[model samples]
Target: MSDNDNRGDKPQGPDNGGNGGGGSNPWMKSLLIWVGILLALAIFVTMFDGRAATTGGNTIAYSAFLDKVDEGTVKDVNISRDMISGTLSSGEKFKAYPIPDSTLVPKLRDKGVAISAKPEEGPSMLMLLLYQSLPFLLFLGIAFFVLKQMQKNSGSGAMGFGKSRAKMLTQKEGKVTFADVAGIDEAREELEEIVEFLKDPTKFARLGGKIPKGALLVGSPGTGKTLLARAIAGEAGVPFFTISGSDFVEMFVGVGASRVRDMFEQAKKSAPCIVFIDEIDAVGRHRGAGLGNGNDEREQTLNQLLVEMDGFEANEGIIIIAATNRPDVLDPALLRPGRFDRQVVVPRPDIEGRIKILEVHMKKVPLAPDVDARVIARGTPGFSGADLANLVNEAALTGARKGKRLVAMAEFEEAKDKVMMGAERRSMVMTDDEKRMTAYHEAGHAVVAMHEHASDPIHKATIIPRGRALGMVMRLPERDSYSYHRDKMYANLAVSMGGRVAEEVIFGYDKVSSGASGDIQYATGLARDMVTRWGMSDKVGPLEYGEPEGESFLGYSSSRPSRMSNATAQLIDDEIKRIVEGGLDRAKQVLSEHIDQLHTVAGALLEYETLTGDEIKKLIAGEDMDRPVPGAKVSSVPKAGTSIPKTRRPNGPFGSPTPLGA
Candidate 1:
């Protein structure tokens, strides 16, 4: 840290006055242009006043001059090209315009007034030059200013086009440390080596091992990739240079390449620094995807980045950390072994990670005694670090809106509902028939979930409208699973189709509403994945027919044309349909067998508008109880105390463990 104290004032880029490409500051240059315009205007006004001669004369009309001559009172006269000036008998200097007449001068002579014709006094040579060139000068000045500004804003300005746009955060400024970043402990551990290398390169170099030139962070969005890089900088106590991928490219060609070179040059001077490029896929897409026939600007930029990462000369003391969600689209050259030596994957947080993330985010907010981070985390599956942070903020906001001083578990539940299903549409008015229909639909989903052991546990079932849905049934897993088995997949499909089955069974097939549109779509997709991706179709055998939409290098998908014939394609479709239909039949059977239970649950829903999972379970178990009034709040659902058993898929990751079946 002490070593970096003096380097804090080091030059950054053109924006910070570090000389690289151009000298004139674009903003200052614009100011000078405007100042020139104001000066030109002031000079024009002075010249106009000089011509008026307002201080030297009392103005008189031409007829007055003639009248004075007729009275023989005019003493002297002076005539110019279009004006007449004379001294009257009263000794006042008068100015007037002369009329074109031959008799005028003769009358002046008969009056015995001294008359003389004076040559017009022309403007001086300097003023004359200014008069001729003022418009051109103003135009040139304005044009120059405009061109510079366009270049500046367009990212192709002569002065700054090649200069790096990276903003440096000094040791003191970069206050983020490993302590602030929660979740993804494995990624943090992997990056710890980078911190060690930056702190003392000799420790690794002496052992004949060169430090890695770069590390690429691959993850879904909002997974704390950038935050990890900042933590590395804070841990190593070095300067951090940050920039976005889009900042490198410009409308003008070759500018992006030049910026890459300038950025590396800056990083070299400030050695032992971290250069973080967020969303690197923007500039590092596969080459030869040309716009028309030739190489595009982005390709050239990526080429330069490739060379800079592992050029002929060593890039000692500089570590590049790039984050991208679309690693599949990145060029092979940029991700080669020598270029980006390490690839760290930052996936969504599991249950444990989610709890840690919640703890980190909740440090600043005041919470009630019953606010448990573990319960909230268990309820939030597939949540990234950013999402968890947002959940905490939203819960605080919900409490504030209710005039509460401290956030309670109730607010957390409300916040989770808002984040997952969208805000409640309390203002939406519905008829009694619509309410009853929604209640039945939700009860169908809840009952189906309870009957299917492989399916997740029901968290809540409500007829109240949320987001775009008329009703919602939330299913949350007690613990994390990395993969899904066929049983679970089938159960999930059955649960998704339960609403449509219930509607068809109760209201008749033709009378069923379109509220199950989303459910059908989800169920269909699940069935398709089972056939094409999971190889669960007996006719299709153990072969995958679907071509993923991106490369699978880091578990990302890329698309390819299908090689199967029309007959095989037809078989795949048939298998998908068979799976979906089987699930539908199962859901219908479960609902038909327990029609009485469905009626009871739906009745409770109509009475309360909402029902907790425990309450639904009790009602389905044939328990009789006093129901609350229509507007009374229902008791909070019990927290899940332990994780459920997880089963692994045939050829998938450990398990597909997501909170609440997101």
Candidate 2:
């Protein structure tokens, strides 16, 4: 099992790269130092020039120029009252002024031929220098800092072209082991071999078996792909290099490729290590197929990755593990032999798996003894590992909010409902008539599920508004099963249409409701699949309509086939219609046979706002009915008191009040 499957320790941040404190870039520091020096020079120039403010004119230079002009032999002289004067030198008059003693003493002894200075009131050269240079310097400093900050925030340094963006977690950092990862037994078994290979590569080498170059973990997000990779690192006790696929791409063209190279180099240095790339499809997408110019930086990075995986010397202990939900979108070359040769599917957890996941996450959380993880798992059919973990956390929060000390079974059920539908909109005001109608609609669904379908049982039926629905009837499978039988599909369709069927039978017509829109869509889809895909209808025979040619954008064909003759197409359409009408008829017939019971259940639903499968069973079997045979327990009803009566069977009449004695 992968180390991530274990939940022995808390997750820690990445290790400090040998350099020490938090890994700041030396280049950034050097750039900041250069900026500081320039800023200091600018400040010094401004401070010394404060003297030139009051003494308007070129203070030092003007005084010195006048000293030279005064000391020279004057043949011709010109002066104006406005302070415009000329220096007489060799019978030629030039503009001049009196020299100050401070300037004359130094220049006469220093350099000859000094220029004249005038007391013209204007801004000083130093003041102009300060005015112009300061803004430019300020702009330069600001721009430098902003760009540097942006680079740092982007997980790379400014001009960090060659650096790898992969986050490294040493063995000491990750505490999660195989025990934490639950539910994905197949994925764990496959990863266990990887751990074994990493621990002792020579064992395989002795048998002339080569370790897989890479393993691609493909599944939906939140299925613990990255966590599984971390588990491998923990188990193998090696450094784990982690990076997102998007980390490779930047505005620069070849930078992504450079980053890929750097990452591989680092992984090689760590030798007996694992490199986990999350969401690898971000870079490994099918090349030359995007809307923009055919040239893609991501494709280049992917190509470089291929080369790195194959071209380099086959290091015995190094392994590459990548994860992506959209594995179908990845480059074909990347999936070829020797590069991601093995694909492990991290599917959503089954009932047993979910229970195990719950047990793992529930360890830290204070849970009531009555809380059963299996019950919670059965309630959530399609929950992933992350979803199960979230359910536990949500249950804990719900418990705390209700002033409870520990998470109880009731809180878990509430959390499951919240996760499946949404938060209950208790604030949504419904009139008496509307509430009654919603109750009938939901009860209709529950009744059909209870009577018509023996495989899938009604979990809960509620008139409470949640998300886009005014009411909802949740039906869960008796157990986790992969392949759906034809009978089950037909039964599901009937249950889906139960709402509309009941409305027609009870009110003589259907009342158009936004709530039933999703149900209707589901029912119609199932009927269409029965005719075209599943071939459940006699008219369609046992032949599939066949999947469409080329890739479908929504994973289903939007355009109908144009090749078939009109008559044949009409037959197909009629067959689809017949299948749907037949299912609806079955639904109506079932609801009609138990019309009185449906009303009873609907009435209870209106009063209670929610009913478990047992409650529905009670209303259907009449007041004096015995407990039904065991099937599947849907949602649990709140116990009447501290003691849950033994009369509460898995599949039994609902609201069977607690027995007086036991």
Best by TM-score: 1
Q: Each model's TM-score, in the order given?
A: 0.77, 0.73
**Candidate 2 Cα lDDT to native:** 0.69
Report every candidate's CA lDDT. Answer: 0.77, 0.69
Model 2 superposed RMSD (Cα): 12.4
Residues 155-228 of candidate 1 have per-residue lDDT tens digits of 55667768878777554343678998788999998899888877788898898988888899999888888788
lDDT of 2 at 497: 68
Count backbone clashes in candidate 1: 17
Off by over 4 Å in 1: 1-33, 63-93, 100-119, 149-154, 158-177, 230-239, 246-259, 286-301, 359-371, 396-411, 426-431, 509-514, 535-582, 622-626, 629-662
State candidate 2's TM-score: 0.73
lDDT of 2 by residue, 3-77 (tens): 000011112223332212343576678677778868777776767677445322222244444554566643322
Residue range with the least summed lDDT across 10 consecutive positions in model 2: 1-10
